[model samples]
Target chain A: MTHHAPTNIPTTGPDDLVVRGAHVLDPSSGLDGVMDVRISGGRIAEVSENLKGLRNIEADGLHLFPGFVDVHAHWRTPGREDEETIETGSAAAAAGGFTSVVMMPNTDPVIDRPVVVSGLVRRVEGESRVRAYVSAALHEGLKGERLTEMRLMKEAGAFCVSDDGLGTQSSGVLRNAMLYAKDSGMPVILHCEDHTLATGVVHDGAAAALAGLPGSPGSAEDVATATALVLAAETGAKVHVTHVSTALSAALVGFFKGSVPAADVTADTTPHHLTLIDELVQSLEGMYRVNPPLRPEGDRLGVGEALRDGILDFVATDHAPHASEEKYLPLEEAAPGFLGHETAFSALFTELVLGGSLTLSRLVGAMSSAPGRWVGDGAGRIEAGAPADLALVDLSEEWTVRADGLLSLSGNSPYLGRNLKGRVVGTMVGGELVQDRTGARFGSRA
Target chain B: MPARNLLTLEGTSRADLREVLDLARDYASGTVDRPLAGKIVCLAFFEASTRTAVSFELAARRAGADVISLSERGSSIQKGEGLIDTIVTLDSLGADAIVLRHPAAGAARLAALHTEAAVINAGDGRGQHPTQALLDLHALSGHLGGFDELEGRKVAVVGDVVHSRVARSIIPAFRAAGMELAIVAPQTLLPLDAGAWGLPVLPSVDDAVDWGADVLYALRLQKERMTGGSPRVPSVPEYARFYGVARRHLAGGAVVMHPGPVNRGVEVAGDVVLDASSLIPDQVASGVAVRSAVLALSMDVARSRVAA
Candidate 1:
């Protein structure tokens, strides 16, 4: 399999610097202590108690971890630049301590052909602040009818293929696409939903009944997930299910994992799914509207347990952004999504880690190493010979999320007005400072 | 009562219901007072409505308030004006109350966010029609003698309860008014886990009559429910056979009610609609008075008058 490295253009080459005296934690490498990490040629050269370099950053009392990798996000470039551009989206990811994000290809003129894939890669290289990988659409225009050229798309720099905004209705169509993706060595990211059952805007529950809104049953997600898993077992294709909101879907993934050991299936649940429930939809606010809609408390707890038990593999911020006009309407007419890139870690930290449902190390693994391994980059580790993708966080600091304070162009986050305990102070991609909130500079380069 | 907007009737108190019903009774008795003389009421209907819109307009005019009407067709709303923009415009025009009928659920709540005006939800998609519930209660209470006499009275909400905004509002409001409620609909036409509402699910209209129901509140059988791409009911005849309240069902001294623009023979027998026991006409007549009470209460005009 040919590895397509995530594309990004750093302003300066090969920083010779040291991140000093920070509580370095890399769960994958089993290093959890205060250490100085040295970087040379944009790669971590050493991690020790005391390391000195020409340029040093004093990161005392802060926590440093490998940068997060978001396997699912919508940058909304090329089509809805008004909602989010690649530059702003990457900056938001950097602020959220995400070093690498795979962009979903449901843009205006959907990214199905090799030309579109190559064009997006070039745009990411030129405009993005952090590494951004392109995932070409599995179906042309995401219509789920005709398969795109997956092998050619991978050759043109696509790391995966997805038709994220919509689900493939036909099992035959999805199976054919999976076969093509398997041959092309591209992982298939499935957003599973039976469209007929998902006709309602919110999760079908007591909240929907009370609010009198139309509801989509969890069977919608479960049925589609079962189909995808069965086909994955049959086709021997690598399938990564994004935004597994319902408990049954996660259980389906777990069931398939044991039944078909060689199926090669992984699943992710979003931070919103981990913490929020369908009760929020009772307010009828559009910001709470999302695809695979926020489920009941039982489903929320079940999905969280799945992630904690490793039945669900990682955390991916399906960071979909929409303009205010699109989001601030009535629930039925509003666009379905939340601005996820900026709040992924803080939300998880406040809700999961601090709440004792998940340990910080496990959270780090899910956000960083697990997804990074899936991305096939060998990136998300603070070790020698690995890319210096890192985040400096002030874990003790308490900050409230505000729309005006978010780096993303759209202020559609459900976390708006939430007080979180941890905040990303600084972020580095390949030893270059992509985000700096330290308010102090240690030294200048020679 | 602390909330300015009457978005839903789910959490409404008996005292609040009494206040509205009493005022509506007085208005029906030809009470003369202009509590809303200085107020401006804006009627914004993004969906088509005949009874709700006309009655709200008549209610506001009868209370001597200045009225402004906006409909989806032949208006700036038709030109792609958002609900928020229209709400802001109404608020900016010094509207003291905005009666809204929108085609999306939660529209009244969303509109309440953008404006200071008290939003009265006439009907919002498949969501609540709070005022309709209020007027229904008023009509029923009048027929039953008084609100105090409504206690332990059994009413069966029959047919298409899932898609009916009327059912959504009436279920809670009627329950809060001390009426014991049961639902009579096909399994396909019921909400998810309908039994979770703590109400009995009677199988047929005959069973509802056998269960000693005092009232048979039938909801309109929407045309789409029977003829749409995926039919909820097999046919109109099949729906009427089991769920419709026929004239024979009224032998047990049960009255029939429907929120209208009703299909005459679908949810209720055509002859049964004009039966002496049918309160359908009274439900419509109660609209203007009950809406007047609601508008006055929402604007705090009635509250101020009581305080004075």
Candidate 2:
């Protein structure tokens, strides 16, 4: 078998991240044109046709687009560098065209209070080239009880309140959190996996029985999702799903699209979930393993189809990272979730875009503006007053995902060495160069 | 017609019939990412297989479709996820094809049940592994120029025949291809229906060897499969002394073949698999490719009728 092809990087000058020539695409602004954006003092000065005394660069072979915003990303700070420090995670985000990411509060010391949220935000700001936002926990410690001080955390710079690593089963607790969230004017992004049906591993199906592992059935996610929706509708708070990996959950998203006010309920599916399942996970050993574990291949395709049909909200890399030594066990024993930040867009492009399941505009909308609208983030559109958060992608470059040399700290991407037909060549955050071909100019690898 | 590859024997004209030769070629040469796109397969294996079962499962998945492996271990036959209930369950679950491996002969045909999906016989106890037999035929054709021309060619299948399911299945397939088979085992080892299988039976491997054997297949002891013991070989050492393929015997380019999990020296030398004429690896490789095509074809047949 062939190892993944070496990443073919363009031999170009390394100044600031600039793409002067490619067609710009921003679905939120109805923008599609050959535009030029000028970066100065780490902010967009202008986006016009031509300008003298500017750093003249070539972007003829690519497509300029708004930087993707992953509202739900499990980006740990340098505090625990072994399990995805901020630098490594930010590098992954940059490679995926994500200039801004709202990290989930599921670290060792879960970010619940203003102090924790502020600490994480400042840590990421000081360490990462890519912009980082904090989505602190709703409950004090994510113990499934007692609402955290949502207002104080938001004022202290928490982007949103989310109990994402797990969901609270008690309706009273959820209702209180959403009620608090409604008051705070922020959404509660929930990880819709019911603990009652949570088997600590994967979906209980034919594959689970054959492998003799515990099953994390679809009913679990469905129940939690329904409960969250019921609470959201009652409290009038926005509820979003972090990483949806099942068809049963996807059908609920379809219901959301047609449901009244179309749910303020948004959901995102990971590229790993969109591409693989329990059977493939079993074949690849525990390497194919992930939480909300890869549902079967049927569900994988269903999640992709739902995204294409506008039933699913967006695509996010619940890019949880773990040390390499942790995955040396069977399906049930190994840790769940795969690192997918770097290969996110490429895998989606291969499965949905190249397979003709999703159009390019749809892909851009789901990856960028959709999440932007859901989180109320400033990143996504390329309108005149918008921040210069952007990405330059070459849609025709056929890149291969090689695990051994992957940028993410964890080598858990299921698409390792899978053929992909597109690549993000350059990424910009506030018009400053976060990542490009030469090397990261912010942190050591950021 | 797009030339549907029929997995069943019924309603298959010679024109519709996919020749064993063509199936082998398609498997060997063709490649597709989503060969079974928008499809689902209900895999029913009555018996267990670690290698073959998992291989076929991987093949179906690699073709990009859904696969529902029915739980038959804790099944209540009719009241349970038995053969029929399992098929019905798959139908309700929107399965587009079925890969059936049963202990009963002709189970693949019986399980088709009028759905549009192709019912592929992964293997049926002693009924047939048509794909395996076809692969065998293709191997023999390559070695001896063609099955039609193997009029005088001799094959030595030693040890057990009475309890060997492979012997029963390959007999008809070989007969269909017009190749004469030489059953080389003792009277205790030979099945009473051996002549009814329409082949000349011999008393020992030496008979075919003396008659200039073109191929040798040393059968597995099959201890796990045997419910009761029949004296096929007086002793394993005795059988090996008389019929076991030695290195010197296969030096003349005569091939050695076995289904697998070869019992090192009891049946044949350890070096036999690596010998220039062994067909073992090629046979193993074909299991995946042929199953992929069969899986894809089955799905295409069922896709139109199975609903979202």
Give the TM-scores of the predictions, in the order they appear.
0.96, 0.57
Tens digit of per-residue lDDT, candidate 1, span A146-210: 99998889889999999798989999999999999999989999999999788789998888877
Question: Residue by residue across B153-181, what tens digits does model 2's lDDT show?
Answer: 66777666654556545555555565557
Candidate 2: segments with Cα more than 4 A from true spot? A1-18, A39-53, A438-446, B1-308
**Which candidate has the highest lDDT of all?**
1
Q: Which candidate number has the best TM-score?
A: 1
The per-prediction i-RMS, to one decimal, reads 1.5, 17.8
Instruction: Record all residue pairs in model 1 with backbone atoms less than 3 Å apart, i.e. clashing.
Output: none
- Candidate 1, residues B1-308, lDDT tens digits: the string is 33378999988888889989998887778764777899899999998888789999999999889999998789888888989999999999998999999988899988998888899998998889999999999999999999888889999999887788999999989988999999999977876757657789989999999999999999988788776545789988888899988989998799999999779889999998878999999999999999988998888787675445
Q: What is the TM-score of candidate 2?
A: 0.57
Cα error of candidate 2 at position B240, Å: 49
Please report how far candidate 1 places residue A105 from its true position, in Å. 0.3
User: Chain B TM-score of all predictions, in order?
Assistant: 0.97, 0.79
Candidate DockQ values, in order, are 0.62, 0.02
